[model samples]
Target chain A: MPEAAGVSADLSIFALFWQAHWVVKIVMTGLLACSVWVWAIAIEKFLLLQRTRTAMNRFEQAFWSGQSLEELYRSLSSRPNHSMAALFVAAMREWKRSFEGSTRSFAGLQMRIEKVMDVTISREVERLERRLLVLATVGSASPFVGLFGTVWGIMNSFQSIAASKNTSLAVVAPGIAEALFATAIGLVAAIPATIFYNKFSSEVNKQASRLEGFADEFSAILSRQIDERA
Target chain B: MRKALTISAVGHAVLILWGLVTFVVKPLEANTTESLPIDVISDSEFTQITAGMKTAKKVETPKPLVEKIGEQKPVEELTKIEKKPAIQTASAEPMPIPEPKKPEPKPEKAKAEPEKQAEPEKAKPAEAPPPDPALEAMKKAEEQKKVEDQKKVEDQKRKAEEQKKKAEEKKKAEEQKRKEEAQRNAFDPGKIAALLDKQSPRREAATGDTINQTASLGLASGRSATLTQSEIDALRAQIQACWNPPAGAVDGRELIVRVRLQLRQDGSLSVDPAVMNRGGHPQFQIAAEAALRAVRRCQPYRLPIAKYDVWKDVEVTFDPRDMFRG
Candidate 1:
């Protein structure tokens, strides 16, 4: 049987945190908060991006399923929450508003519809990218914050040296370990946040381009229809 | 959106719970120490018991036994009581056998209490045949006085021995001073010049002799009969075993000390080692002392007799740069 000494040794991560100085403790707590926020935002954005892609695919299929624009608009139960659906609805609403004022006022109808769609696209992209700045900040700033913690911990280690008048490795190893743990946690918070922020930013860009392509095609179709009526 | 928000909130809650478990709750569990209750008697209770014993002792009168063992027994003499039990049992065994012979002298007493009182009086005499308590006390006082006198003699002898040691140390220091003075007086330039002239031809021949010896031995090419790397390593190992440098001498730049040794043909040091160069710092002094101690402890090195001229007056530099201190 193995000895129970391993469990009794005060060298666990939790023990290091418990033995850390107050400033180091604050640093650790901040890093932990950053890690939590990074994970939460990553998960939320992942779900949101997946839902947006699915909604866009479904809306595009409906738009190209030989169903009339009025039929598809009536089929949607409420104002669409996904970016692509919101963009389509905003453009269609502008089209309907222009028609309500004048049926054949084709001078600025396409421009007005394009302007509304552009505004809605920007709004939807902003909604899609909510909480991503937190990820970027955590990725860029956590390491320096952890470095500050390590410097503080090492300073404390030197203070212990002066107070005890001994420079043995046993006297200072735990302090250094606690300090390095801060840096390790910072890296842990940073790496995934950085990876996911880049990934989510690219996904938003792809969605925006797809929405813009759809908007231009829809405006072109409207322009041809106005020409036909005139 | 609602589902995603709920999922994010749940993820945050789980992460927070994990952090709390590892940092707070688990640490608390690990830190929990089992406290045992110790029974401590109060000071008042101890004082009361001591007071009761003092009163009880004052009320009781002393017994009138023929041999009171307690007062007559010295602390050291009590150690003998452990050995006396076997002798007591051996003597008691013979007392029962002698009971029949004693019945003739005390016929009326033996008949009145044949088993108990007659045998006990005879057995008591057999067990302890010592004098009265007052007489024993006088003898014990004399023995204690003898022991005290012996102790005083031993203490005087110890003092004399200490004085002798101090005188011997002083004599050794004076002898060392005399030897240093002799060495200073013996440094003659004329003798050194004559010896160098006498050994010059032999020194040239010794180089050829070393070349021939190495060639014949085939140990290694370019070898000489002088101190080789292996010999130096052996010398270093011997000295290192004895070198106990002072603690916290980590900085090496200021701790180097150079000493010159003059060894005889038989490897015994011919003259006192002279410190050639020292840093003049206190730490350097400590290092020099340590190096000198090492040289002293590992004296009478086994040097090659043929290469005595090479190692006869060698300069050793004590450098502790490679020593790792934590």
Candidate 2:
């Protein structure tokens, strides 16, 4: 009388899990995976970018305070953590290699520095960009993937109705609902991936610019040291 | 780093809060499967049977009754012939002696053969003459006559019994009708009016005594508040029935309002402005005022219609806390 027993009319657990067709289940699973992946990238990139920015700031301060190249290399190599400093050491080593073979002139030094700086910029860009393509792929493609699942799910729902000869809302609503969930998950997966991708890329570009600026300044210091030695 | 952590913490908190809200207020009891079954067959079964019969008839040939009868044997033929005579006798008209004579002749023929066979040796040729045939025919006629006469006597008796039964039923119905009519006529309008008038004063006196007793009791109880308990209860019931609290009254607000009033003999209320206390909420003040207005509009209140002293001056408190707290 209080509507406690037969009145419950709960959707069975099997029905809840199997409400979506197999295709929809797959799509939702994929969307869920994508969402998790995006969140991981967002968090990982946040940490990586934070670390790089902090390290770059410290390295720039040390470099500008007139520490010798050898001393700076030794200190930075000991830590082996700063991405910007690593790039600097690589470029400086290459410049030193190119200078070792050449008659050491202003023109040769200038050319070597320019080439080293370009290579360093490219290497730093690569280091900053690890696994970023995956983020972009997820951001750009997840919505369409979710849309595909939704459309496929809806189609299957209609097909089921045709097979069962039932056209009622109860017969068709569950499948459609499951399909729409895929699209909602897709958007959930896409939005943050796109946001973090943009944010990390910008931060990487900022770090690259800082590294390039530091290279030019370091090259000027090197030229001054050479002139003072002469 | 600290700012980022704080922002993340706030974001997680909001997301968790929304998730909890969604869970708590989820549409758990939706009637999604409240639809009729797909394969309803009872209504279709009749149609299907009818259609099946129609198709069977279209495909099958009809059989003749004569052919069906010929399929049965010699015993069935004799039984049918015997039953035909009985049926003819039962239904034959008295005026139509021709049909009855036909069956009587057949019986005579059969009797003659049986008589000849049984009494051959003792038969007197001259004595077994015309009288014998005539006597036998007369006896058969007399037997039929006796059966007809008995049936007539039975019919007459049945008619007489039926008439007696009908007469008794009619008499009973008339008696019942008279009793109902008498009952309807028993309540005289003038007497009823006099009785009602007689009870009114007694009711008023009893009510007045009750009021006086309650008022004295209230005074003696030593808590001589501005209103009596009976009056408070009545006013509370009235206001409770009248007040519809405003929609979306926020949670965690103490929404109690107390209104004191002066009542005239006619049950009209003049709210005591000095005694009206509006608890802190501004909305509570407005709601209390509205409730008071509702009470005034619902006047002249039907207070224990006979008693005035109990409800002469009353204080009513309106508390919306219970209604809106959840």
Candidate 3:
């Protein structure tokens, strides 16, 4: 005679995946999705910030290379520019508009330039930070989701134990291992999302400040031009 | 967004492929009860954790049986037959000399059970017994046959000292216990075993626990071992399952049958079990034959290999009264 046939324990990954409760399966699937989405957002956001930083470098080089302000503005306003170029164009547009009519509105032209630049800087910062909230949400919430899956799996295993009435390690080991797999996947998804979220948020802040510094310098250059024209 | 999804799919595919190649765990007591230190290596250990056959090797294989016996007894007990020096007289109550060879150095690894669990002390006890009957005689006959034959006893003492300095003391203690036990048991042969079990728990604790039986109860050189009460009960039950009491044999005279058995280490009969008191009555012969058949049918008994010496030669009395759990 031999042991009862009910307790056949297999702990392979695929077996674990298929044998787990539906709740745990769904949790694992969702964690995997979070992983994918986090990586995607990280990639797109990284590329976006890199592009803006380079564009700002090019725009700053053109502005300070002894080129005329009007010429720089003309060239940039004609073509789409991000970050520093966009702020320069918005400010120069208001300056150009004031001088167009016989009664040039030089009375509030600096204020208008500052207002437009402020709007452009905020808009550019908003673009650079797109999809980052998703990263933060996934990072913070995924571990808890994984925990839920583990709880559900453990509960399901206990139920099976009660049903079978066998307390052998063979009876319960596979189930517990499968249940813990949900947590494993969850940790995989959560760790990277958290790391990237912290990294991207800091990069976004640095980019915003660079844009602001450029805007301040550009306004100073415009103020000199306004004094010369007046 | 779609390109990100494609890249994510690729990454996931690599992860899953790695997982399929590597990530796994194993369980204890599924097939070999053989699980420990699992990592990213050896997926096969984790792959086939098939269960339910943990104890399947214990079933008996039947064999052709019986040395016929006739008219049986009222009540009988199991008797151990001490051969050669110990076989002085059948009626002279053969109190066992506690065979000197408590341990043999090696057993050429049994096929089904490859137990290498013999600790270092087993070797220590091997050379202690220069007086062992079978395997030591054979080993001595081989090692010192043509050369240094008379120096065999002196060589054994030297070897025993070399292996373990405590061998002399251990042997002295064992001899003292066996002599004391043998002296005490010259009264009754049947009560000796039960008395040994009862008295030993107290007396042997003061003496030592490593009172090993002859280790080579199997095919090769070995040590001694003993069965616990539960294990003895299991062995008895296994035999009883195969036993069929002769239906019409009634009365106190035909109730009991004592069979003297000589079993090899694997639990099969080394020689036909001799029925000690076979009378010329037909009903008694049926009872005796039935006992012999049960003994023959149960082959390769699941006695512990560690305790091989204790059960190597056991006398079982088949009584229709106790349902053979006795």
Candidate 4:
């Protein structure tokens, strides 16, 4: 009776531990870690884009508020944290240099300003788009990678059961749970990544449009001032 | 910027809270104590305490001796008093005390006279007992009886052992004799050859005479021999008995062995030895040769005594495949 009791007790504990299955435990742990990482990236990207948008909007308003260019530049020059402010400073410097040229023409001045603005826009867009490609890759490919892992793990589980000659529910349930866990993790990683990628792309587009609009407006304002001076 | 700060702060707060909950909560739940019923206690402290109590009880109880004898008895009398309770009780009752006290002083007087008498008795026995022939004879008779009884017992034991050994030896000898007789009676090649030789020549001579008679009657010119059907059947059966094919020969191959023999004037097999001819599979050639050797070993063949001429120049065709097919 004691020997039987010992076996039964040990079997119960073993069953408890085996309930999760080794493969399921591994898959669940990976899913949990991936979920945490995705959430962190989403939160960080959300905050960064929000801050950049706000700063661009504030700097644009300050630039177009009927203040003298010299005064506005002087005020914004100290704050390099603003991306659009940096673009404005670079364009303004190039515009001033062209105005002081020996044979400076209106067309030449406009061309120089356009060139500077184009260069600044490209640089700012590059900075905003950093790490977005990696997000897209993770969004598109994570499900397949998790699928591969699930498939391999299930294959191994079936092989083990075949060798052991057991097909009971207790033996089969854990492997199935582990396979499902991998799929769940893949979805968890992919959904947010896909959503955030789309969101970030749209945000970047809006910011690009704002930048182009500001550049056009700034060009018109500068041309009016030059005509008055001439 | 403020919105971004708020979002970052909330994220850090959730992560830290979850980490703390995971690390601290589950361990506490797992470690909570559960009550269990006590069955048989195995603690040593209780056993030790019980043993000490029993020892204390033993020490507290009064001894039987102390209960019987007064505890205040004088130390000088204690040893004498402890030896025997009956004697002590008798002495303690104060009867016969006067006689015992008088006799104790007179023993020294009595002891000296006994020693004088004892020395004389010891010396007289040594001097007087030597002349007593009856005693000496009695002592000799006792010793002789002891020796004779020992000899009788030893003779009986030796005789029983000899009888047992003789029976074992007789059994072994009978077994050995039986084994030797069985060996002598068993079949031997020399005896068989001698028996065959003695009978074969006479039979062969008669067969030659019959063969010659049949040939003179023109039996060889006919399709069948001049011998009757019964005689032919008997010869076929005898030859069949003599032939034994070698083991493991191919069953598909056909083999034929022809033997030609000559007869002598006395009607025994004589001048030209038997010749063999083989046909069919080359693999069967080895088997055919072995079969021919067996036939030669069985020759001068036994035959009907009256059929000498018909059998003498006999040509027998040995076909093993036909025999094997059935």
Candidate 5:
């Protein structure tokens, strides 16, 4: 009857974490935090991108359905909204403000409307991409961080080996296991972050392009309207 | 941001809970403790060594264990037979109560019965059948002789069976004794010394000249004679863990390097370990330096501190042939 004595200590996840050297504990906790943050960012971005795309799609349908631009802008402007609606409201506001001057210099009105849409598009893009750097940083750095923890843990094991003056596998295996766990968690945090970071970033670029496309079409319509008004 | 944080926290919580429920360090299923290569002497054994005496007695096998059960069966059988007659006599009249007393005469009565039976067989017709007259006396005498002859054969058979049982018991006891002596001999210092001596030639073949040098150094202290083969192997394994052998050398296996280093009791090198073997072979110098680096990297070594006297000035040979072959 061997008591799994080759290496065993209530090797539950909690046990390994609890048994690790303090530096390794910190590394594991930090990596877990990074993983959690990555998932949080990914989830929020995923939902935000979906919502924005649906809003853009609905806006495009309404814009093509022969709905009056004035009526649509009036309906959308009252509600605090995002994406295409925000761009439309901003451009219409600038268009309306230009006319409110009584002496409408139609020459700059189209330019102002275009500038406002561009600003709104940029702001919306910034909001979509906010806090994405954390993911990138974690994806790139956590593995190295975990490796550091492992090295520190193995060093501690070696020190213990000398202190105890015993080289039996039993003596250092737990320490090494605990150390390697930090690397494992680090990879756990890193791989998903890396994969999602790539996916979400590409999605963000697609969203930005969609917003720009909407802005371009809206600006063209506004310039045509300005020409007819003049 | 809040939503993401909540989701992340929930995800981490689920992961931790799943890990908590599922992760278990199952010990290796096979027993690793059997005759382990134990490398240290305990404090009690340390005092014995200082006093120039043998260490604590090794654990011995429990002898005659099976024989104890074997020895008991016959007594139980004899008691069963003895109890049956006692029960029969008691049943006839409740007064005999020799259930307790019958064993005292059991031996004497058993011995007395055959002699008494022999005389009565011939004498009974001569003595008791006189009243029945001539015709019946001869016929009764013939009947008594036949019955007595049967009883004699039955008694002889029983005696033979018992003698066989006794011989079996003796053989079992002798086997038990021999086993105990073998166990004792295995623990004998002289036998161990002989076993160690037997290992040195193979060890010398394996490591070249390091073991002999360590052995001579140990003789001066009257401590251990040399690093045991297992200890040498352990050191070999430690150094090899860090060794990076040079590649691209033709027959790289032949470039064995020996490093002679002194260790402090703490298992660290006292000085830079020196490579003892060098040659004109192009790979020799590269392999030698790698060996020296490995020795430096693996230290402080995890040697048993109790045998530091023997291992302090030890030599280690790095043989890369196995690596090349493997």
Candidate 6:
């Protein structure tokens, strides 16, 4: 019965916002915007990350399945959505360029291939980790923004007291609720942003490391071929 | 890159849509019509006040109605048995279709029976009379009993009516008394306004003795006024510790409650603390109640005992300005 009565009291999010002072209302709006943007980033990042991992696994499996590297490279070159396939293409293109130019020493050619692969890995990692700064900003700043709203709301509440000279709970409850709601929204925006930011960053790091390993192995293969040819 | 942007845009749009839907769909019920700060009192106090009303209702129990019906049943049964014999003797002849000639009060009794059954009296008397009345005395006795039953029912009805009227009168009297008391205690706002107008000029013209008198009365026992500002501050602080106005009261900042209470030399409240100038604004009742409870809860106030002449009758005005400010 009390719970039902409480609901009827209109302590809902919208009502709290409506009842809030102008400053508190602005705070709530900002927090809401943060929440929406953070959630969108989280969703986009999660999907992209999942797709990248799946693609990397598929490319790794095909690369080790005893298929010819050149045939595999040609197939991946047509559509290299994943970082692994892109890295392979980058290294293979460098290898072809080095062979076409016989003026270059074998050691120099190998170094160039390795350098190209490293550059490609960095670019792929950067692309994969896009829009993560928004998450980081939201995570770090939302709570403080919420606190600012609360402080402003409380100031209004005090001013109301000076004007009315009455110390009843009903007068201040709505304002305080409005103030607290900003903080609550802040936490709501911040928590997921923080969690997913950390999760995605680590995933990006792992993917980058995997690509580096693949580049190193490919470089070794080329080095052995160059030694045999010399 | 394009897929991620599209996904982010779609997700962002959905979230904003969800927020807007929530904002428009549900509205706050404006049931906060009682602009009273009721939360000042504990739940138990509310229940106790409600329980008092229940007792008032319980005093007018419906048991009397049922008893009245039970008392009438025996007389009714005797009449029924008496009519049965007469009907048996006449049963031989062909009864008229309209039965207008039959002088029995069947319709009257039928109407009364429905009323009796409406209440569902538990003691349904089933009287089995003999084939005949053996003596004239017995017939007279049954007739007397029927007359007595009629009188008893009429008496019961009059009593019920009287009770209802008395209850209503008592309720009205109480309401009137409360109103009168409220009027008596209410401060005249016009007088306060006039006092404010004259205050500064009067203060400048006032003699030294009158100023001392005002100061003494403002913070003293009726006998001798010897109070210090620090002691008054201490008392105020003690009460302030107990005064937790509901959030609404703080928001309605213009509401300041001045409670006048008598305190013993020991600093305990002697009488029930009352909100001075109550009933001026109906909205202040809850806030007043809260202030009263705060004064009551912070008993044995830490006032300076040496100046008993100064701190006996105290009036505390709770202002919400500092609370909201902090």
How would you encode candidate 6's per-residue C-alpha lDDT over B93-146 as one tens digit per residue? 434455434334456666866875675456445533222324456778889989
CA RMSD, predictions in order: 27.6, 33.2, 25.9, 40.3, 29.8, 31.5
Candidate 5 has which clashing residue pairs, if any? Answer: A4-B27, A4-B28
- Docking band of candidate 6: incorrect
Candidate 4 stretches with Cα past 4 Å from truth are: A1-37, A100-107, B1-326
**Model 4: per-residue Cα lDDT over B180-214, one tens digit each:** 98988788877886656454443112211112211
Query: 1 or 5, which is superior by lDDT?
Result: 5
Model 1, A15-83: lDDT tens per residue? 878888999999999988788778778887898899899999999998988889887766663768788
Candidate 3 Cα errors over 4 Å, as ranges: A1-8, B24-326
In model 6, where do residues sit more than 4 Å from their true spots? A1-10, A102-105, B1-326
Better of 1 and 2 by TM-score: 1
What's model 2's overall lDDT? 0.62
Which tens-of-lDDT digit does each residue in B138-174 have in candidate 2?
Answer: 8998798788878978998999999999999999999
* Candidate order, TM-score descending: 5, 3, 6, 1, 2, 4
TM-score for each predicted model, relative to the true structure: 0.44, 0.40, 0.48, 0.39, 0.48, 0.45
Runs in model 5 with CA error above 4 Å?
A1-8, B28-326
Q: lDDT tens digits, residues A43-112, model 2? A: 7678878888888888888877877877887676665676678767875665566467656555566667
Q: What's the i-RMS of each model?
A: 8.6, 7.6, 3.6, 10.8, 3.4, 6.7
lDDT of 3: 0.72
Q: Against the true structure, whose lDDT is highest?
A: 5
TM-score of chain B, candidate 3? 0.31
Off by over 4 Å in 1: A1-9, A102-104, B1-326
Single out the weakest 10-residue window by summed lDDT for candidate 2 chain B: B61-70
Error of 4 at B169 (Å): 95
